[model samples]
Target: MNSSAFRPRLLAAAVSLCFAAPAIHAEEADVAQAGQALASISVTGARFDAEPSLAPVGAIIISADEIRRAGANDVNAAIRKVGGVYGRQSLDGSPDFGLDLRGFGTNSSQNLVIVLDGVRLSENELSNAVLSTIPIDTVERIEITRGGASVLYGGGATGGVINIVTRRPQANSRSASMFVEGGQFNAGEVRLSGAQAWDNFAADATLGTQRTDNYRDNNEFKQTHFSGGAQWFASQFDRVGFRYEGARQEMQFAGALKEAQFTAYPRQTLTPNDYGSLDSDRLTVFGQRRLYGHDIAADLSYRKKTVESTYFYDGVPSPATYDSKQWQFSPRVRKLGAIKGMVNELVAGVDLTKWERTTASGFSAADAEQKSKALYLRDELRFDPAHEGRISAGVRREIFDKDYADPLTFAAYDAKQALNAWELQASYMPVANVTVFGKLGQSFRVATSEEDSYTPLFNKPLAAQQSHDAELGLSYASATQKITARLFRHNLTNEIFFDPTANFGWGANTNLDPSRRQGFELDAEHRINAAWAVNAHYQHVQAKFRDGVNDGKEMVLVPKNTLSARVAWTGASQTADVGVQWTDKQRYGADFANDCAGQMPSYTTLDARYARTFGQWEWAVSGQNLADKNYFSQAFGCKAGIYPSNGRQLKLSARYSF
Candidate 1:
């Protein structure tokens, strides 16, 4: 089908399913109840437990069961199914996948914020988050809050925020699980997890290791992760906890391929000896108390990471090491009361963080540091007792102090910046099972250490990036069906990004001219029957430079359209699922001039899984790229800089409960 006809047909099918929901047999009322329960689940990523219908923005929650149904092996694999989001493999050959949201293209990682159990996983560098270090088995749920969220997350939230909530021990219970898996291309993994709860104390721990000789030559990868936590409950509303996590990873890079090279030898490496290793450790202490109708909580954490890599420069071997450390503390309080005879909720919080990194090479050493502090407050008012009408407003002020020094070059630079963010949101339920919501906000981002070090202007700091964001949406939820459609727009100034054409082709990180990104998204799901279910999502985005040298030019690597769908079946002791994803063509990475000879080609892939439970154990088989399609979704130049997507692969796994 043609692109124009494809969208309408898919959308009509989804609408049909939603409209047909009312005809379902009365016996399926239980299914509707279950759907309603899921919709009411609280979203912790918003700083407080708030339901999607009660919030002004769009939010999607992926439960652990849904993750398993998708047969995702990692966090990146799981979240790629979300609307308006895309994932690409790391160029460095590490397991850290880059995720793009709302057409941010090459700067996606710097625009999106990632949080793990309330701890910011997004770093102050131009690098992606190490999602592979998070064991899938330990995750309870994943919450995706779309649009600018700087008012609560501080910074780097122009695209949104993703929070991964882990499983916790339940009171008076003890449980354990073990998982082992083996797959194509000499891949293997093992994981062990246990949790215990007694009296007022609870504890949980997980250990996992994985090794794989991926589909390409010289692309071996290995990683080990360990995490544990303990909590003491003084009362039903008070608690203290401690958490520790550590990870070690090593990998070999299979350098990028040119057109001819990729066509002839897609799985061969150009740089055979390139390799890297990473080690990270983190510790956190947190506590919460409730008194006098007020809830207070605090979190303190420290983290350290070391990375070493060796790659050929000018056909000569060169090696470097990076050491980084960070400290963070956050405290917040929430209260419920009455305002103008209406129900009201107020939340206030403070954030403080310090980070520093040192890079050592054969020539000289360089150092960089960033310190930030922020304060924010938000208030929500409900006009009715049923919460059918509500409005909220929030504001945040943050300050950053940055410094960079290079001994060899004798270059030292320091900068200070202050940024502000505010948002006004409203939601109304005019009829049963229907909601209309709208929000307007402002967000900002600061230059990373790497970006600052390569500024085109000698010692002059780059301006901070800023954006004006707005969204309007409507949603309908019922026992057997759920549908949501939204329109969003972002107008940005001084967008922090790398431009290869800058400084006479020397390529430096710099601020770009005015740009805009606007899109429409549609998401729908229907329970066909007691054992069958189907869901699909479609997104259309227009991203371009609004003014300047590249006026009206399409942004590089930002696809205009994307779609995904899935069907699942469940029986007495067996479950099966199938899914497909499609992406439209777009300009190559760094091709901001829109002068590339050819755009990256559009592609589609299929995935499927089947599992059966037997007594206290379960077994499953899964396959990715089932059709063995050949395509490349990422490229950095007009014709070269290609990274091929993996071909057909299959895996078998088993899990046991103890």
Candidate 2:
């Protein structure tokens, strides 16, 4: 597979996904009008709006059109198209696809903050995001602010921020749409959505189901989701809103495997050791009012999630069964003031959460739970309409509840800890067409007792995790093209992991080392002509271990180079698109702290789609993996080989609206 023959085959396959548009040379008349204009105001803040370039930091604004073009129901696919974003699958399990920001993979939710509207979506325990359950249909747009935002967000702001804005109540519009398609390896999907508006109140709902043979033999999937919302204006001075969402998913789980089967038998048949059920529901209520020449706002949110899993071998359930639950609420208060020559908006908030987990094993019984709380604040000052800069800062203190241990399992242990984080962020627009931003931040995490002193076979306490992040970015745009690039670095303390060893053959969480990761990324959008459009992004990341950390190990399983591109053509009655993605070798082992493999091998994929509209009938056809390059994403495991990217799949779909 490493022969020179590989490059040509790869290039040939990738070229097939492209749908070259009929090119038309642009007239000089249009070139002059493409004035170096930059994009403006983004809804990633308190009022669901703000001028990001003017804010002085790095923010990735994803439009609704981008969402529709991705052609995938899962939100992960939406972000995956970006350079700095990646998703991971549970080893030997279904490629669950958890959101990763700036290379901070799974179970690192605290660093990668996720917010729905204004409510926190990351929970206690793992303090990670709930990416798999959020329905794409419920999202109007998403703004991803890269770099530390804890000065306003709290603990999870260590890595950065993701703000999801739900669809707003539409005006003078009524519509409903549905799509159904079937593809390679028994993959099929159906999606439906409807919306209506009357006066000042409106609402929308969406539902979808997708089943696939997955890239591996025993890997398969099924997901069901529902989302809806309502809003109202009580008076000229008062308003209120409510939203709800629920989802259920079941899938197989495979732990990472031995190298013998990992490389030598990358495609050999494999089996799953467990099955899991993930159920989640969320609700939100918010209110805003204008009084005494100032506007005030607040919100209350509630979330409940449970992960139930049963492990088995040869049809017999094992002791690895796990059950967990979470309860959380975050509230905020803000005041907007307009004075003589200045406008000031101040915001403050608090987050409350409690979580519990229990595992019953054929070998051992283990149980643990924690309750966490955080309070924070931020403010913005507006000086001039075209030349305004702002500063923000905040700190959060998290205290955990007393540990509760499973009485029957002598091998189980419990522990509690705390962390205090602080940060400062600023943004500025030196010119109307350009923006610059920077941030210096410090954030830390209390390690789980498991990371310190725990071997599945032996209970031991491990150390904690602490780190700091710094970022700087610049953005430029014109009518024809827009570009954004950012550079960032993170230094760590007590880098934790489950180390790999002989008796400790399995990775057990441990934190006795230090490390750092530095990276840069560029995202560009260009309109080549009336019929041609291009979306391109690239990233480079490097991780190095400090002396004696993880035994001075190089960060593995994290790709150092990633790239993505999509070119599209739209005409009078036809639309076409081509996309490609590539990733550098990904390091993986039986566990996080042990046996680091050199790489997963660099791989690429090409895909294309075409659609046409004639009268009341509409149809589309899509081709995936045109080169059939056998590849793998962090999404694959043993049974889910990171390399099973479907052997060239094509799906054709047609629909009619009466």
Candidate 3:
């Protein structure tokens, strides 16, 4: 069926399912209880402790077991299996994969927000988040909130929000684990982790090292990671903790290949001598306390990073170095009370951050700095005792002061921007195990330091990107099954992006014409029996220029259709899983005119894993791209910029507990 016809049918099916719940032969009391239980499951995506059902949009929560069953090597690998999300290999040949949501394509990194334990991981520059630095073993759960979330997360959250909660030491417990793995492409890894807890003190630490010679020449990578934390429980309702994390990474860049070169020799590298190295460290101190029916929390963190790279351009080696530092502090309070005989919740917070970067190149040096402050408030009201009917509203105001200086040219410029975001949401349960939710919000993004420095008008600051976001959805959850269907749209103005054809083909960062992204997403999971389970996700999105020269033209790299499915089995002490994903054809990157010679081809991939547990030891084998399918999900130019995807890969791993 055509897209126009399919959308309505799918929507109808979702609504019909909500009404048909009563017809199912199940205990109404049990279903109602299950529904309530699901509604009360706490989530941190809202920057406060709240139930997932109270959120304006659909959310996906991935547990640690799911990540393990996927046999993912990193956080990005695990996130790709989720619906309405796509992951692309990093251009720098690092493990930091690019995750795209809502078809933002080339600008996906700038549109999405990533939070780790209540700290923002998304950088203020053009680079993607360093997902590789986070060890998968440390992850307790991942919460994904779909659609704009600028009200609580500040800027650069126009696409969605992903919160990664790490594991913590448990009271009166002591455990240690060691893991070793070897895989194709000369990949190998070793990790050791341990935790100890006493009556009032807890401590945990992790150490890891990895090395890989990737599929392409000049793509060797080596990394080492270390993290440790200590906590002191002052009382039953108060605690303070401190954490330190550090990493060192070295990698070689293979560079992009042309269409012809990719077909002839996909593994060959034109820039064989290009190489880069990075050193990063972060320290965080956090505290939480409960007093007078209110919960208060705060976090302070400092991070330092240094990177150096050498690129051989036309056989002339050019070396550069970058140094950056960031400091952030956030404090918040949440209270639950009764208002007019109904339950009410209020959350208020403040965020303060300062960041600076210095870049030194062969011939010049530059410095950039940004200071930001924000205050936000969110409140929710529940109409019924079970929280079956609820309404929430939130607003945030943020101010940014940015400065740039070119030391060699004695040039300096400063700019300041103030942005605001607001959202209103409501959810109602019309029947047992069924809920309908809707939301309308405003989100905005300011120009990054790099984007401002390279504007078309010389040092002039670009306009803040803004979007009007809205979504509606229905969800049904029971003991054995869960399903959700959502329809969302974002109408944007002054979207910030690089336009290669702008400024007389000089190529510069600028605001684009009006654009819109509208889509439908469906996610479902079922437990067929004790030993069998299945899940599936489907998304259909239309991202296009709504006006100007590229009117009605599809955005580059934005696919219209994507689907994924997985089957899992467990019996005795053995577990097995298989999954498949398919992506539809899309316009090549930089093909804003939608007149490229050919679209990026559609492709499907298969992955599988099998594992067995033997007392305190576990062993597993996993494979990705089992079919050896060759496809590229990222390109910078029409038919020219190509990054070849990896071929078939296999790995074996063993873990021992003590």
Question: Which tens-of-lDDT digit does each residue in 555-634 have in candidate 1?
Answer: 98788998889898999998998999899998877578888788888999899999999998989999989998888766
Runs in model 1 lying further than 4 Å from the true structure? 1-41, 50-56, 82-84, 234-236, 385-387
Write the residue-wise lDDT of candidate 3 on 473-492 in tens digits: 99999999999999999999
Q: Per-residue error at 88 for model 3, in Å?
A: 1.2
**Can you give the lDDT of residue 62 in candidate 3?**
82
lDDT of 2: 0.59
lDDT score for residue 303 of model 2: 60
Total clashing pairs for each candidate: 1, 30, 0
The TM-score of candidate 1 is: 0.92
Question: Candidate 3: where are CA atoms >4 Å away?
Answer: 1-42, 50-57, 82-84, 234-237, 409-411
Give the TM-scores of the predictions, in the order they appear. Answer: 0.92, 0.83, 0.92
Candidate 1: worst-modelled 10 consecutive residues by lDDT: 14-23
> Relative to the true structure, how large is the alpha-carbon lDDT of every model?
0.79, 0.59, 0.80
